[model samples]
Target: MLFKLLLLGLVIWGVYHFFIKQKPIEHKDKEADVMVECDKCGTYVSNKEAIIKDGKYYCSKKCAGVEQ
Candidate 1:
């Protein structure tokens, strides 16, 4: 009985490992994530998260001197 249970478990595991297809992870683009230097304080940050004003890059809106 124990041998049969082990064999059953092994068969299930093999089927799951061989038959399942994993989806590939998708990203927007590599260039969008490139590190950019902050113009105000020289801190490095990702291009997508940086604030842009007057053709300059800033780590935050505070550094860019833009206020709400």
Candidate 2:
């Protein structure tokens, strides 16, 4: 009986690990993206997130001197 119980428990654990359990998540590396310095604040921001104005990079619209 103990052997059967152990086998059932093993089967359940296997099923949970193989099907019911969540997969390991993969994260993006910030270091892999290009970083740019903001012209006004000199803050370093991702190239994708930085705002471009007059051939310079800015961290935000306010730094770029945009009214809106």
Top candidate on lDDT is 2
Reference-based lDDT, each prediction: 0.85, 0.86
TM-score of each: 0.53, 0.51
Please state the error at residue 11 of candidate 2 in Å: 51
Clashes of 2: 0
lDDT of 2: 0.86
Tens-digit lDDT track of model 1 for 1-68: 99999999999998886655332223335434889999989999999899999999999999999995
For candidate 1, the per-residue lDDT at 35 reads 92
**What is candidate 2's lDDT per residue for 1-68, written digit by digit as tens?**
99999999999999898764444422235445689999998999999999999999999999999889
State the weakest 10-residue window (summed lDDT) of model 2. Answer: 22-31
Instruction: Please give the lDDT score at residue 13 for candidate 2.
Output: 93
